[model samples]
Target chain A: MDFAEICEEKFDINRYLGLLCHPGCGGTSVFMGTSRCTSKISDKTVKALDYTAYVPMAVKKLKDVCVNARRTCAVGNIVVAHRVGYVPVGEPGLFVGVSAPHRQAAIQCMDLTITAIKAGVPVWKEEVYEDDTRAWTTNAECFWLPKPPTHSTDLPQK
Target chain B: MDFAEICEEKFDINRYLGLLCHPGCGGTSVFMGTSRCTSKISDKTVKALDYTAYVPMAVKKLKDVCVNARRTCAVGNIVVAHRVGYVPVGEPGLFVGVSAPHRQAAIQCMDLTITAIKAGVPVWKEEVYEDDTRAWTTNAECFWLPKPPTHSTDLPQK
Candidate 1:
C-alpha cells in the first residue's frame, strides 16, 4: 500500500516510518524538504516559509510518482507527504518515504520518486526572509538555483 | 556539525532529525536500512538480524564519510547511525541523514554517503531466518547480492 497527500500538520517521523515499514522490506529511503534560515538568493536570511499547492493536481501527481516507482521497481510501500501553510526554519515542509525488499530497489525508486516530485509536483513555496524580502519558487527551480553565497557574518556559523 | 557512530540501541527518528536539523539547511535526505523478514537467499525467510562491527575501525570510517561529504558538498549537518545487536524485522538497522543549504547538496551528499557506507564500511550482518537457516554477510555484499525470485507464496503481499 502507499500514501500520498498534502497536509497542514507538522510531520511525525515515527508515524511516517510506521506507514512505510513492511516486514518483507530491507531498506527504506526518505527525503525531506526543510525550510532554511538562509537562502540561495544571497544577502537574504530566511525566517520561515509558506507553502501552497493546487491540491487536486498535487495529490494526483504525488500518487503518480508512487505508481510509477512501483511499475519500474520492486517497491514495497511508500508514504509521500507535502505540508501546506507556514513552515518555520528547521522544520520540514515535505517528506517522501519508500521501502523495498532489497537495498537497490529502495534506493533507486526513492531517487526516481524524489526527482519526479521536484520536476513536476504542483507544490510551490514562498521564502519569508529575515529582512522581509520574499521570493516564490517552484519545486523544480529550487534545486537548480545557484548556491547561496557565503559571507563571514552569516549567523549560526556552521 | 556532523555525527557518525554505531549503537546497540534502537533508533529514535526524532533524535536523529534533531541532530541533522540546522537553520541554514533547506533540504534533508534520509535513508534507513530496515531489517527484513525476507532475504535474497531463496527458500529462506528472515526472522531478524544480528549486526556486529569492529568498533574502532567502523567508527573511524563512518567519521571519514562525513568528512569526505563535507569536503565535497555544502552540507549543513549529518547524522549517520548503524545499530548493532539484534534487530527484528521492520526495525531499522541503519540510518543516514544529511542536510544542506540547497536541495542538490543534500541529495548528492546523501547519495554519496550511503554508497560509501555500503562499499567499504566495516559493519557486518548475519541474517537469522525463520526456517532455522542463517547466513553472514558484509555490508558490500548485501546490495550486490542476487535478488530472490518471487513466488506466489510470498507472505504479507503488498
Candidate 2:
C-alpha cells in the first residue's frame, strides 16, 4: 500500500519504518528530504524551504509508483511522505520508505519510487536563501536531472 | 561525511538520522533493511537472520560510494548501517541514508549508495528458518546478485 502525509510535526523514522514493515519482507528502504544551508542561485545560504503540492494528484501518483513497484519487483509494504509549509534547514522535508522480501528488490524499488516522485509527483519548492532571495523550482529543470539514455546493442544474452 | 557500522546492539533510528542530518543538506534519502518471514529456498519460513561482513573491505567500499556520490551530486552526508546477529523477522537489517542539497541529488545518491553496497560489499547472511532449519547464504549465485549500474540508463529513468 501507499501512504502520504503533509505534516508540521517532526517525522518519526521508527514509526514510519514500523508502518512500512512486513513480516514477509526482508528490506525496507527510506529517503528523507531536508533543507540545505547553501544556495546555488547565490552565494548566500538557505535558512529554510517552503514546499507545496497538488495533494490529490501527488497522492495518486505516489500510489501509482507503489503499485507499479510492487508489481514489477518482489516488494511488500511502502510509504511515501512529503512535508508542506516551512521546513527549517536540516529538517526532514520528504520521506519514502519501501519493504521487500529481498535487499535487491527493496533497494531498486525504493530508488525507482523516489525517481518517479521527483519526475511524476506534483510537488513544488521555493528556496529561502539567507540573503532573502527566493525562487520556485521543479524536477524538470533541476541540475541533478539524469542524463539522457544511451542506446547500446552489444551484450551477450543468456 | 561517510559512516558505516555493523552492530549487535539495537538499531537506533534517531541516532542514525542525527548523524545523517546536516544543515548543509536539503534532502536526505534512507534505506532500511529488515528480515523477512519467507524463504526462497523451500517451504520453510524464515524466523530471523544473522549478518556478517568483511569489515575492512565493506567500510572501504561504503566510504567510496559516499565520496563518489557527494562529488557527483549535490549531496552532503551519507550514512549506512547493517545489523549483525539475531535479527528477527520484520526487524531492520540495514539502513542507508543520504543527505543532499536537492531532492534529485539526494535520491540519486541514495540509489547509488545502496546499489554499491549490494554489489561491492562482501557481506554474508545466515538464515534461521521455521522448524529450526538454518543455513548460510552468499551473494554468489543468489538470485539478487549482479546489481545494475546506478546510472539512469540502466533502469527505467523516471
Q: How far off is each candidate at the interface, as Cα RMSD in Å?
A: 0.9, 1.4
Native contacts, share recovered per candidate? 0.97, 0.96
Point out where model 1 deviates above 4 Å: A138-158, B138-158
lDDT values, one for every candidate? 0.81, 0.72
TM per prediction: 0.83, 0.74
- Report per-candidate DockQ: 0.68, 0.55
Pull out the clashing pairs in model 2. Answer: A30-B30, A30-B31, A31-B29, A31-B30, A32-B28, A33-A93, A34-B26, A36-B25, B33-B93
Q: Candidate 2 residues B56-148, lDDT tens each?
A: 776776677677767777767788877767888888877788777676777677777766776666667777876665766545443544442
Worst 10 residues of 2 chain A by lDDT: A148-157
List model 1 lDDT by residue over B45-113, tens digit each: 788888877888888989998998889999889899998899989999889999888777887888888
Give lDDT: candidate 2, residue A65: 74
How many pairs of residues in model 2 come into backbone collision? Answer: 9
